[model samples]
Target: MASDAPAGEVSLLDSYSPDRPPVTAMRIDFSKTPLAPHYSPYFAMVIDSLLTPAECAAVIASAGSNWRDLKKGDSWRECEQILSVSPDWAKALSERLAPHLPDEIKVLKKGDVLSEHIAGPSNLRASQGTSKTVWRLRGADERLSFLRYRPGHHFKPHCDALYSPGDKEKSFLTCQIYLSDMPEGQQGGEGSGGETRFWPSRTGMGRQSKKSGGVEEDEQHTENESFLNIEPKIGRALVFQQRMLWHSGQEVKRGEKFTVRLDLMYNHHFEKPSK
Candidate 1:
């Protein structure tokens, strides 16, 4: 996704002091596809009490003067800001989340700087090496983004895009920690509609194509349909993979809603055989 935050090394550690409180978050896995008729394992879960109320406040305050209004047409309309944390801090967070996460996503090391990997060409050259590569969790994205939504703010239905720092390092999962809660029953925009909703995936999970005058034309699918509604709660976090999932942020109604989004970075390397 396109970002508006100023480039270069913008560390959040400069502004916000991170506090280490007792790890209190507990993971609640979704046994089946949300709002779906048939039973199917889902790659998303809610980690309750991931942060304390004070921690959430500290993160929101960390944005300070960095908040950028990223409103564009109907696709995305929300305020966003970014801050990078120290590798130590990121490692600490990874440890806290380790018990709840699957083995495949275990953080093994810090990731490369965005410029060193993302903007550069793929480091993996077929001529140099040829080993089967599998994505192994490295750490979180260096720059963590904070999103704010006031009344009438929202993001349209769209799938989260993968951020490939290098051919060996890419992001496939998203972790969004909620800072403010907009509970249910509050009336304003479609029954207090600041909830994150997920919809059914399209066939092949790809764009549609139609033949026009013997030429095929690509049709971009655009719709805000959803059946599952995840209401915001202070200290709650939503973690999901960026595969065929299509979701949106429903418009905020009466109050303000805030969230901190972090992508899980992974290193693509040849798997080592177990002894």
Candidate 2:
């Protein structure tokens, strides 16, 4: 992968566009925790050892093209729509985009329901029971920006804007991959305070809490503890529902924190398509 801004399509729909770089060689090795029943639909899973230290560094260097100021948004307006306008061409284009989507989107069906859940590159039209649901893989911005939190650089608690799928049946997903983490483990890398803190789920009846300075205050944790904080492990990806989860990155205290954030779009499967 060339580091400079992707030489291909780099927009919200880039992954599904013909000009987008081919990601078919990539793999999704999901963690066991993100697939649990309680975590389904709204989850954040991590996969370790996918990239070596050097490869991770190369990707960062390649992002030199249009690295812009990374900021947090409270909401995302409807961005765009993707249809089978060029039926044959779009289908082929969708194939290239599938692999980069979230790995697990457990179909919650009690029995085999023959409905298409275009959420995965595998079993795209399968007849399986509950499966993992991670990335919607609908569409995403191709050009990526790196967020480097230096000492005292921090983002406050907030929910990512829901990308207007132009349809209510669709939602979005977010992926955070660490380019570099502070404290350098062997250097007694206790890990900087750059952990991504996730609040309780807002859908149905999930955990409820407020964020003070981006740090979530969960009733589940003791007064000394705040919300659930996941360390930014190099090569580990943190994937979760973009709108459903209230999350924030903590302030960097000791060293610097670098991360690449990508968004995924797809159908929520609330309804089946009309024949």
Cα lDDT listed for each candidate: 0.58, 0.46
Candidate 2 TM-score versus the reference: 0.53
lDDT of 1 by residue, 1-275 (tens): 33333333423231233564443543333334454531133466777766677767765665555556766543344645455444544554455455667663443222323222222223322232434334467667766667888888887555666667675677767888888877566444356568887656553544422210111112333555335667888877787766445667878876888887777787766643334
The residue ranges of model 1 lying beyond 4 angstroms of the native Cα positions read: 1-39, 80-89, 104-131, 183-191, 203-226, 272-275
How large an RMSD does model 1 have?
8.5
Give the best candidate by lDDT: 1
Off by over 4 Å in 2: 1-41, 65-140, 165-171, 184-191, 201-225, 267-275
In the range 1-275, model 2's lDDT, one tens digit per residue, is 21334343322233334443323223322223342233333444565533445546755654553433433233111111111112222232234334544444433221222112222233233332444322234544443435676766666555555444354223345666676867854465555678887644434433232321222322232355335677877755665655445566776777777776655445433334224
Q: For every candidate structure, what is the RMSD over all alpha carbons to the true structure, in angstroms? A: 8.5, 10.6
Query: Could you tell me which 10 consecutive residues in candidate 1 have the lowest summed lDDT?
Result: 208-217
Determine which window of 10 residues in candidate 2 has minimal summed lDDT. Answer: 75-84
